[model samples]
Target: MNEIVRIDNLSFRYMQGLDNALEKVNLGFEKGAVIGITGPAGAGKSTLLSCINGVIPHYMNGDLQGHVLVNNQEVANLTFGQLAPIVGTVFQDVDFQTVSITVEEEVAFGPENIAIDPAEIENRIIHALESTHITTLRRRAISTLSGGQKQRVAIAAVLSTLPDLLLLDEPTSELDPIGTQEVFEAIFELNKTLGMTVIIVSQKVENLIDCDRIIVLSDGKVAFDGQPRKVFMRSQRLAEVGIAIPEVTAFIIALHKKLGQPISTERLPLSIGEAQTTLENILRQYGVLS
Candidate 1:
């Protein structure tokens, strides 16, 4: 896979702060991969996302150092107009990304602003709404939608721009369990079907179960970056940094301790079905279950 985004020796400090929000960060994301960014509060996950979208030095005043490259172009040097085509960001709060009242208008807003051909705008709007599974809500008022519906609409709005990379900040933070699942399902489809590079900053570990890799941040630096299973295996290290593994992984860990089993933590499962299968096999072998 080609590198869709890169961060090299990146550092940023807010106007009121002396310490950098990000420090010497280095990372790369592959095209068509879903990468999850997680850490304790104020660990610079949001800052890093902003850097990728060129919002830090351009929209917000701050001291910034290092390079953020989207599609091999430096983000700091790119104008908002220039970055719009390559990177689209859906904020944690959907309200911030909303511009029009109706769902169709909101999805068409970005393409319209860029002066895309009217026919192309219609096609993009239809494609985005269909991609996000919000086609039925095209003419509905944005205010009438639920939080999850609003989130889907927000994502659809960004997709309408046909960005190569999508950045989501706590995309499911305001959602219920079902809502979260709906959003994740939509995200999975987007990544698998559209081959869009996805970078998501989220605290919800379960939502990241399907991510190709999970990058854990701490003190504005890269602490862990690898497969989700590998990262979840370090439950202790993650806890020390105020991050939690998926519920199923946590359950297996506790079961292993209670049953005195020597299960490999490194092989911890991410989903409930996997955990159940593993547990059943172990229990049957030990004659605990027939």
Candidate 2:
């Protein structure tokens, strides 16, 4: 019942373009849920986030139909100043959102712009730096941070606003594996401790294995939307559309096939750790070993 964002009959087209960037999309997100959005290029994933965060009709030149609501308030009805506290977005390019030279300053920028009390702004900056595990880097110049660190800094900057929903646009796409892990750890940790709802767009399927839900868009429409397991159960369907289910999920499916029975999607593992536990249990259940 605590839905944070809702989209109703939404559709949009660039002012000069011929096709709708999004088409009649209807979706809802619950508070504290970590949902992953995935699909091919130009599939409206970013556009969807833009709508919820008031970037579509308010800032961008687009023909938008329908509406997006954040915390039951229409996004388009709210001013940018009003929406900043309800939703925060981190785009693929961290530089766009990060303006200050130092990590601490970057984190403080959002609250400062909103004219929060100085004491409250300082407290929010401290909380954000700690939440993102970048306390040691607080005074470090933004130019010296690695891609991962920079992304974390950007996230902390957004967190400073204490938004209810966080919109991530491929924040980890350009990071190395370790960097990717670092960013996800910070994000999921914040999601756990702060009870923040997150909507992340990524083509990195495996990383999304832990998401509560995966929504796949194809050609500006909702082609698949369900729990991770339920959506990945359509592995073949995903592959046909140039999307690969996680390698771990594929291995589990193959193992089930080798046993002459299909494993229930409910029992499949989306991650390597889960796969190990599942396989061990299966061997023990079949009396293969102690």
Query: Per-residue CA lDDT of candidate 2, range 192-274, in tens?
Result: 99898999999878878879999999888999999999999999999887799989889888888898877887888889898
Range of the 10 consecutive residues with the lowest summed lDDT in candidate 1: 260-269
lDDT of 1: 0.88
lDDT of 1 by residue, 62-153 (tens): 88988888888898888999988888999877897798999999999999877899999999998888767788999999999998889889
TM for candidate 2 is 0.93
TM-score of each predicted structure versus truth? 0.93, 0.93
Superposition TM-score, candidate 1 onto the true structure: 0.93
- The local distance difference test score of each candidate is 0.88, 0.88
- CA error at residue 262 for candidate 1, angstroms: 3.1
In angstroms, the error of model 1 at 59 is 0.3
Off by over 4 Å in 1: none
